[model samples]
Target: MGDLLGVAVLGAGHMGADHIRRLGHVVSGARVAAVADPDVERAKEAVAGLSGVSVHTDPSAALDAPGVAAVLVASPGPAHEEALLACFARGLPVLCEKPMVPDSAGALRVVEAEARLGRRLAQIGFMRRYDAGYRRLKALLDGGSLGRPLILHCTHRNVSSPGHFTSAMLINSSVSHEIDAARWLLGQELTAVRVLRPRSSSGAPEGLVDPQFVLFETERGALVDVEVFVNCGFGYQVRCEAVGEAGSARIGDEHTMVVTTGGRAAQEVAQDYLVRFADAYDREVQAWVDATRRGRVTGPGVWDGYAASVVAEAGVRSLETGHRVAVDLAPRPDAG
Candidate 1:
C-alpha cells in the first residue's frame, strides 16, 4: 500500500457514481484508482474530473489496474457474489454494498469464502450502523437505560418506486434495511416473518403492491413491525421506536428548519436516501478505508449480510403465500 489507498470501484451506476465522487473528493486517505462498468462511457464520466484514474468495461481489468490496493463492489446484487469471491481470491480487502447477494444461498457462499481465507476481507455495506441517530440509540440500548426491549415499530416510506420495482422487492430490497436494522438493534436473530397486504395505493404502478406490512418475531420473543410504503408520493422517511420495559425511545423524526406563515408550519423532508443518509455513508467509507489501511476488516461482515438475506428470503415467502414463514439460517463459520 502506498501513502494513499487506491480503490477500484465496480459499476458506475447511481450508488457507484456517488461512491466514486466520495472517494475522489469527500473521503480522505483514498483515491479512485480505477472504475469499471459495462458502459465504458459511464465509467469514464464518473471519474472525469479525477486524475490518474483508469476506466474499464471489465471489473477484473479494473481490479488489475495499476495502483489498485482495494476493491469496492457497487455492482448489482446478482453480481456481488462473483465480485466478492474474486476479491477473496486476490486477497484484496473489499467493501460491498448491501443485499450482499440478494439470496441466502449465495450470501452463505460469500461467508464461506471469507472463512476459508481464515481472515476477514469483505465488509458488507449496511451504512445505517454508522448513522448518528442509530449509534446514539444503540448506545442507549446497550447501556440498559431503556430496560429490556419489548417491541420495535418501524416505518420506511419512499416518494416513489423505480420502474423495476416488484412486489417481492418490497420485502427483499426495500425492507431488507429494516431487517438488518432490527437485528442489529435487538441483538437477536429473527425467527419468523409474516406479511400482510392491504389495498394497493392509487399512486402505485399497475399490478404492484405499493404498501405492505411486515412482522418479524425474534428469537428472544420480541416483535418488530415495519410499514413499507414505496409509492407514498411524498418524501423519504425512516423511523423507529423501541418499546422497553421501563420506557421507550424513538428516532428519525424530521428535524429540519420549520417555517411559520399564515399560522401554518412546514419542515423540509429528504426526498432520497442519498440525501438522508449522506453522513452515514461518508463515515462508513472512511472507516472502511482506515481499517483496510491497517490490514483489518470492520463494520458489518458477510455473516450479517447472510443473516439479512435468510430473513429476507423468509419475508418474501411470507409475502407470496400470505402465511407466516420461519427463518432457517445456515451454521455460522467460526472465522467470520
Candidate 2:
C-alpha cells in the first residue's frame, strides 16, 4: 500500500458524509485524516465510527491541519466557490463536485485563478470519467473499434432531488454529466446547444420541468442528444450509446449484475446518485490523493470543467430563448 495521504472532506451532509463513510472502511492509498462541517455535532457524527479522524466545526480549520494535503468539497452547490478558494489559498489540491460553480462567471474565475497559480490545483468531480463501463466504452471508441462516432444517445434520470431543485437546475444538476461525457466520447467540444421543453410532468413540483430534450453539436461533426428526466419515478440512471460508422458501443445497465429466483428475476438499480457512482467516486478520490502526493493536479482539468460549464450555461440559455445557442470554447493553454 502507498503511504496514506491525509485528506479532509468539507461538509458533512449527504455527499460529504458519504465520502467519510466510504473512506472509513477501505481506502488504501489515502485515508480520512480530518473532517469539517458547519455543525459540530453533524461533523462529529460524520466521522463517528472512523478511527482517529479529527472533526472540526469549521472546515477551514483543516487548511492548516498536519499532513492534510488534499480536500474534497462536497458542500452544497452554493458554497463551492468559498470552499474552493479556501483550498486554493492553502495550495491544497481539491476535488470539487460539479457545476464547477453556480454559473459561468464563477467557473471563469476559477479558471483564471488556477492559471494564475501556474498549475492546475483543482479537479472538478465528474465521476463518469472514472466509471468502469464508461471508461471501457471510451477505450473502445478511441481505439477506432467503433470508427468515427456519428451520434451519441444519452439519458439522465434522477429518482428525485431536493425540493429546491428547479427546471433549469435539471440541466446544471443532471444534464451536465451529458455535457462532459459527450465531449469525451467524441473527443470534441460542443459547438452549439439547444434545449427543447416538452410537456412538463406533474410528477415533479408544479414549476419543475421534469423532462426536457437537449441537443448539442460537437466540433467534430457529431451530434449529441440527451433526454433529461429528473422525476423519472425510477432509480438514478446515467446511460450513453455512441453510434459510429463501423458499429455502436453502448453502456449496459448497471442493474444487470444479478440473478435472482425468489419469485422473479431482478437486478436492482441504485436508488441514490452516490450509490450509483460509488466506485467512480473512490477512484476519483484516490487520483486526487495520488496527485497531491506528487504536488500536482491530476484528473479532470480546468479546461474540462470550464467547457462543461459553458455548455451547461448555453443549455440554460437555449431553454430560456427557444433558440440554438452557440458555444464559445476557451482556447486551451499549451502544455509545456
Candidate 3:
C-alpha cells in the first residue's frame, strides 16, 4: 500500500469546496493534491489555506494531473458521467457525489465500466450509510431484530437551494437520498415508484416549486415514503424508520431532547446536509481513501449509484404520470 493516497477533487463549487476542505484538513490517509474549477477565483478559494495543493481552472487538468491516485468528484450532476469515465479509464478510484448521474443510462455506463474492470473502483457519496444512527439502524435490521422490513418512512427538508431549483428538483436533489437509503437500509431494490403532490405551502413562492411527496416499493415488498419540502423554513433534516413483523428501528431527530412549552415548541435541526452528515462524510472519505490505497472500495459501490439514479428517474416519471411506476433492475453477476 502507498504511504499516502494522492486525492484530487473536481469542481470547486459549494459541495466541491467543502470536500476539498475536509479532504485537506479532516481526512487522514489522504491529502488533497489538486482542485479543479472553471472559475479561477473559486478554485483559488477552495484551496486558499490548504498547503501544497495545486489549483486548476480546468477539470481536465486536475483529472490528468500526475500523482493523483484517487478523486472526489463534486462536479455538477450533468458533468459526472464524463468526469467519472475519465477516472475509470485511468484506473483511479472515485468517490462521487450522488444521484450518480442525471439519468439511468449515464449512470449505467459508469456501472458497466466498473463491472468490466471487475473491481470496485467507484464509490457513491451516500453519507447516510455511514451515519452513526443509520449504522445502528442497519445493524438492527441485519441482525433480524427487525424481521422482514415491511415499510420505511423517510423525510428530507433543505433550508433552500439557489432559486433556480424547480419542482423537478425535488426528485433529483432531495428525495434521491431517501431512495438510496431505503434500498441500503432494507437490503432491497425498489421495484415500483409513486409520487404525490399534496397542497403547496404558502412559504413557497408562486411558481417556485417545493413540498413534494414520493412513495416507492422495493422488490421485497417493502414500502417507502419520502416527503421533500425545500422552502419549508426548516433546517436540513432527514428521518428514517423501518417497521417489521418482529420489531422496528428508526433514526430519531438529533435533538430528541428538545424542550417544548405551552406556547412555543422548537427543535434543533442541522443548517444543511454538510452539518447533518458531517461525521459520515468525514468517515466516508477517510475510509474510501484508505481503501483506494489497497485498491478496494467497501461501501456504496457503483451498483448503489446506478440504483439511486434508476429510482430517481422512476420517481420523476411517477410524478409526471401520477401513477405507481414499476421498476426493473438488471441482474448483477456478482450479486449473490
Which digits, one per residue and each the tens of the lDDT, describe model 2 over residues 145-182? Answer: 78888999998888876888887888877888889888
Error of 3 at 62 (Å): 0.8
Q: Predictions ranked by lDDT, top down?
A: 1, 3, 2
Candidate 3 lDDT, tens digit per residue, 176-280? 788888888888888998888888888886776568888898787779988889887867878888889998777856673466899888777777788888899
Q: In terms of TM-score, which candidate is strongest?
A: 1
Candidate 1 minimal-lDDT segment of 10 residues: 251-260
lDDT of 3: 0.83
RMSD, every candidate, angstroms: 1.1, 2.2, 2.5
Higher-ranked by TM-score: 1 or 2: 1
- Worst lDDT 10-window in candidate 3: 327-336
Show where candidate 2 strays beyond 4 Å.
Answer: 1-3, 256-263, 333-336
Candidates in order, TM-scores: namely: 0.98, 0.93, 0.93
Error of 1 at 70 (Å): 0.8
**lDDT of residue 279 for candidate 2:** 88
